[model samples]
Target: MPSYTCSTCEREFSHCASLQNHVKVHDNAVVDRALQKISEER
Candidate 1:
């Protein structure tokens, strides 16, 4: 099993697949869009 550390959750995961799926929950497109909006607002 491969180990991965999620940057968003800061939790250690043992498998790559579970870690990938877990990361998606935090990777909302809206969040990314919001960041872009914030940057553009600056």
Candidate 2:
């Protein structure tokens, strides 16, 4: 079977839905980092 891989972390998932859900963690991390940076710049 083919695998769904996360481009950011290179993690592998067996299903597309699982890969999509996993990607949200990375997305949230990015948002968190941006917020932290903005606060630091203030």
Question: Judged by lDDT, which candidate is best?
Answer: 2
lDDT tens per residue, model 2, 1-42: 989999999999999999999999999999999999999999
Model 2 poorest 10 in a row by lDDT: 1-10
- TM-score for all predictions? 0.54, 0.92
Query: Candidate 1, residues 1-42: lDDT per residue as tens digits?
Result: 567999876898998888888888787866989999999999
List runs of model 2 lying over 4 Å from the truth.
none
Write out the backbone clash pairs for model 2. Answer: none
What TM value does model 2 have? 0.92
The list of candidate 1 runs beyond 4 A from truth reads 29-42
How many pairs collide in each candidate, listed in order? 0, 0
Give residue 9's error in model 1 in angstroms: 1.9
lDDT of each: 0.85, 0.98
TM-score for model 1?
Answer: 0.54
